[model samples]
Target: MEDTGIKIQPTMYGIFFEDINFAADGGLYAEMIKNRSFEFTLPKTGWLEPNSDRHSYNKESGILSIIKYSEEGANHNFARVEVNNDEGYVLINEGFRGMGVKEGAQYDFSVKAAKRSGDIQKIKLQVIDSLDNVLGATSITPDSDSWKTYESSFGVTKTEMKAKVKITFEGEGEIGLDMISLFPQDTWKGRKKGLRKDLVQLLDDMNPGFLRFPGGCIVEGRTLAGRYQWKKTVGDIENRESLINRWNTEFAHRPTPDYYQSFGIGFFEYFQLSEDMGAEPLPILGCGIACQFNTGELVPMDELDPYVQDALDLIEFANGDTSTAWGQVRAAMGHPESFNMKYIGIGNEQWGPAYIERYKVFEKAIKAKYPEIIIVSGSGPFPEGDYFEYGWEQLKQMNAEIVDEHYYKPPVWFREHADRYDSYDRNGPKVFAGEYAAQTMAIASPKNKNNWNAALSEAAFMTGLERNADVVYLSSYAPLMAHAEGWQWTPDMIWFNNLESFGTPNYQVQKMYATNSGTDLLKITEDGEKIIGKDGLYASAVKDVNTNELIIKVVNTLEIAQKLSISTEGSNSQQGNVGVLTMAMDNLEAENSFEQPMKISPKEGSATINEGRLEVEIPAQAFSIYKIKG
Candidate 1:
């Protein structure tokens, strides 16, 4: 039998699990609201007509039109109108409802207009109350013969009784107006902050070394056309690109939102964010077609050059210097120094033989130019001889740098398999659990409700990942954020409204595990009593090389609190102080709400080490980290 008192040195090959996919989508879900959709347009004439799409309006030539009658107009019998091109000028008419306007309450005028011929002339906009008093006004000409657009800004004084929009055309040219919308200005702007700053700080505290973007199912589009395209998101804020977010429907659990996304937060923004957070950039680019399997039918190898070129161009854009053409363009956009991204993933979840062909093309080209860069390939599904196994075999032939894996299961499944890769081959390509989450069949369940027992299961699974850190290179929770009103999927880590944000119990658990663990794996054993008496107390240990500090992570998933007596050997009493960081809740289903963000948080306390033995008490339904000076 192994000696219980023998001490083992921690195996230190850098143990923090990374490669957690932690990026938010740049879709309309995050960026645009109802007021921002470009569907609304106003013509030069005809009565305001509602188009099939909710936000747009239609008008014929030569007459002024009002699509949205002012809400104030019902009370005071007046309405305002707004019009603009896509790029710059917004013409507001404040006197349309016979001039007199309400005081103290302001009416907003807005429109969607496009330039048809010469630039718009004296595109004047004004806001006047029912009393013919001009409250505010603004105007501008457009820059293109193309459909350049703009939105005007003006407000009626609160003291004014009522107000409406008025438009005057000085130029003799035809212009189109889809809709001229009017409402309270405040109503149109909505709220600016969606996520809570504290939650963001909590994630930052984990000190992740790298963040894998965008998604699991997010990367896998529902249709070929909806896949994530990096090129679509870049440049100045307004001029940045956009796309239809595929995950929106899943989160919304309904028909997808009608509006397309403006990918303002694209690859460049992700790189910038990583830099800001002191983490390395790991960019995953699309390969060939999105989420569809080819059924082993190959696209003729010669025709795949465009896919290969995209990979090359993306790398160049990320790492090239200002002296180059694309680099110069990137500099002109904003960043002068190359972002120097070192990890590039080719494709997402490609699981067929055709994927091998596709990957081969990208592999040869990328390695030839940037041999130092690590290449990651998606391996989908493995049951010994599944498609994922085939993908892994191909990677082996190609000497792939990393293998990306993803999973989404019920909480119970996670608990049973959290330590799944504990026996994984250590010499193989690094394993990256790109995306994972505990999803329940039931919708509308509260975030804290462990409806499917996911929280406990995931905690157990994470213990395995941490214990086998040498092989499990990275991991992250999937579907990180879901806007409460706009959710497309469920069982997310955080949910937010315009004013506040809250973390789920599972999220708090993950935070506790991530923050308290160290980057070194320690070996430990349990007596028969330790195993038989308590089944939920999963534990792992690590020693910090620099500080010579010993950190032990203990998760007690029982319904009642437990007292732990921890002992160590080959260490002196003169090392340092012992402390315990505990994350516990009174109930298993306890959660944090927007109004009470700290309802479920970590608490710290001191631990006593008497004669090289440390003893601490852990709360019920909780996880704790005990740190002892070496």
Candidate 2:
């Protein structure tokens, strides 16, 4: 295989993050308590006051009462417990499908409390199982007249996936509590407040180009008021108000009413995660357009000022200095040095002239203030459609920096469209294949599987994505994660339950590409022709300047093995060991499971490549990469 001589951009492959399927509150954000703030519409949704019905305020030992703060704020609710009698009164929090606790691991427990009256001397926080068996226990003595924070740590003696945090008090009269929280002491990098170590580790392994924060339809909420507000997501964790996730209602196949964004993993955390992963930060802001799939609500043009301003303020928040207001907030957040964010996306999967109108305002405001900052525009939901074309045309006319395109289609569509970007204009807005997936079944179907068939097709298509690296600047797989039992969407790149997470076969493909992405893109052709599924083969070549090696990727989407005989046009080099990574499966439906995460993962092989041209065998339904020193 020979190098094609094109340069693979550093921002070639990335990842898209959204809170759908409990990705944030349940999956990434380590806050174990659900409805922690009592702010949900159904304030007691995750709370089990079985003691409620058993005991009334008139005759019971204790009862819980809801307290509301000023409606103008994000943290607007707290629970006030009137403990007439301290014994036998219990408040239980059923974590997201029960908190995942590990034996021997220490968990930090904290709560905000104000002694309204009575001598509520001690508050016991215990990680208890379904039958009330304690796995871990810690007690805090709240001493205060005004609201005060109480903290403690408990070492788990036992592990329980469905453990609840049981709260019991001693010598109590009445007390106020808000932001009751429990976090595993062992978070990613041991940060006091951080992301799930396992999940972040998977992303870290990918070496992603950029981390796109707080998004998908979450950016464009079902309604403007429900949209993700970056301002609310920043600041003190306790004050980072909660909101009904845009996905809290009904999805095409699932309804998870309990879903909400804790903002534990907010804009600041996202930037930090990007910094930690050595990836760029790309934040997408709402353009005042609600999800087109839902209400399709559009903020009136006159009322669009705030939305545009949010984009402007975000740029400052990310890159400005303490001299500026928003930038000062970033400094206070502990990252005084700018995140150096170079790109901001205006909308998510939006279309029509309304989008164009709103986009222009944001684009102008952003460019005028920070012309060096690049803005990512949208080409709507589908890869091919009237609105997609319209978006491209309009953005091209505007000389937009980059255009985001999303596609959720069948596996066949991906393989057939390997040449999708080859015909793109050389001088038009560069492409951002922002969100995409090769669905095993129909798009977004619960039955869809992240099988080898779908993954291999994406690999086949990715050949073209790499082949046209000059036109495609950024790309990523969509809806990055899903919590198994609570998911509303299927076919996520990674899936996790309360206990563990595993990358799907698709994730392996993404990881392989990102980790081995060469510095220079090159054409790998057979008989002077591009190999885009010709003879069931799709291939792309590149030269890794740092490693001084030739990297060739070949995908065989056929039923049987095919032999490849190749020769380099201008290369004459000695035989070198070819490091081969092949991800193959005879059964198209094969997938990776938590029990056997690497069952369908890539397998490494050593091949000796002779001086000039190379010959290799491509497996059926497999994606292979060959790296040979030049």
Candidate 3:
């Protein structure tokens, strides 16, 4: 029997916003220790103190104490040296006890000391490099006992240095020091500008259709109170919202190590960013009020109304007009016209029965007022029955517009099961691969070089998604950007910093798919003997309606090169030129760093057609798109 021709349909290639949140959190501490030094008063209590001067650290005490006072400049003082955890370390002018410094550098520091009698003393500061050489020194005199700050600058070589303050005893009297700070001549500060120009151009170049904002886990934390609060994030950069990050494993601190977050770049910023990028905004609202930090708990429905209302108000603000109250407020805020948001997601990865019930509530309320809008519900794994399946079942019963499917698995699994939705019921709700990433431990680790297997697997999966595009509407890669220093997850689509960014090999594959893939499914078949595997060479072909062009996407999964013979049996024009775009790299883990970004970029070549058949060799561990004019 003759084989059946393959079909292709419209598919979405996009990115999840979670990885951007990663950059906001552990990636870059985000406005925490700006310019290196900050000043604060030491509380009398709620601070911990160490017994020895060698070990000065904070545990959890209520007060700060300055101990170890020496008269006439004694090198050591035992009982007089007091310490407090909240107030941080104190400066005792005894022989200039100092803190560790960066290597190959010099620094100058000074402090103002206040005594119990309300008297003040100006103290000189000095720094020593790693070689114990005195690099810089400066003096400061306080006007009053009331808290004062002294300033000075010193130079250090391109090596490590330490900072210390010394009291030159002109007259014999002990001085008390509090609220002292030191500044390095140079510090590795974070990116001052919002987004890099090159990155902005790259984002613009992609011409993404839509943008998913905020985050995955960043939306909600272990508790209902900890969830992302959109209201707190809007307006005024200085007064923007903040929260503790929960994604990075490195944040495993003891005794509730407080990692405060500043929500400077919040919902308003996202809206503005989307507008600037010329992409539609798809915001995810929290469905489950209760959150799980180390453990899970449920929030009462009555108490959850506020959060629900917040979501409603947000939608209104985005889509409403000046005629309405919130809409007017939104206009005053910036955008007078409606943001025209047609899609809004309920919760993220809420895979429980309770979530289904909660989603139903959102669906009913949202649809009641805005029936034209598309409500996307989270659907779990395949074959149905999991929380996602249950959610979809509920959505189907309630008549949902779209259902989201998330998958993160081994590349090999994706390659083998690329046609996951091949037999899916199309009459049911539309499908969106809301979050999918092909990650393997071997390719993701920093220790390994670039691996093309992951990229190939993802490309093969894209081929399947493209072929099954009738049912699979939209898809995106999760954890898109991972900053090297603050990465909690691995194998991200792109890694960037203030100065530079680069797309992964897998990312390039998706980009090519998005840029070149066709919108219509074409009918094509291969000889049984020509098929390499059970599924043969992964392929999808589409004909563009406007340009009258036929695009064929093909992936050779075999280890050895495959020569493919192509022919358009149904078309009148049997012969056509073939434009090939291929992604091939020497090392699989071969990544493009900030220094060298185009190391693994795709290359283009062409092949000639003869009679009605064209033969081409496709390399293994590679992805290629063969385009033929219709």
- Backbone clashes under 3 angstroms, per model: 64, 6, 42
**lDDT of residue 426 for candidate 2:** 82
List the RMSD of every prediction in angstroms. Answer: 9.6, 1.4, 9.7
lDDT for each of the candidates?
0.55, 0.88, 0.58
> Between the candidate structures 2 and 3, which one is better when assessed by TM-score?
2
Q: What's model 2's overall lDDT?
A: 0.88
Global CA lDDT of candidate 3, please? 0.58
Worst 10 residues of 1 by lDDT: 12-21
Error of 2 at 556 (Å): 0.7
**Candidate 3 error regions (>4 Å):** 1-11, 19-21, 25-193, 249-260, 291-294, 381-385, 442-450, 527-536, 571-576, 586-596, 610-612
**TM-score for each of the candidates:** 0.72, 0.98, 0.71
Clashes in candidate 2: how many? 6
Q: Tens digits of per-residue lDDT for model 3 on 1-630?
A: 111343332336655676332464323222212111111112222122232344435323212334533333311121112222323333322111123344554343534445333222334554544353555556676565444545665654433312333323222233455434343443222123243344445555565556786766566565666677777776554334345455533233221222334454567656766777667778887786444333345656666667667767888878887998768867876679888887788877666677777777787777778877777777643324566566777778766677888776777777777778877777888887887776675423433323477777778887777766677777777776765444546667777653346887767887787677555666555763322234347876677656676677777766666787777656543576778898866455556776777767689999866675768988765678877676
Two-way TM-score contest, 1 vs 3, winner: 1
The reply for model 2, stretches above 4 Å from the true place, is 1-5, 54-57
- Model 1, 583-616: lDDT tens digits are 6766655556767766766677886788777777
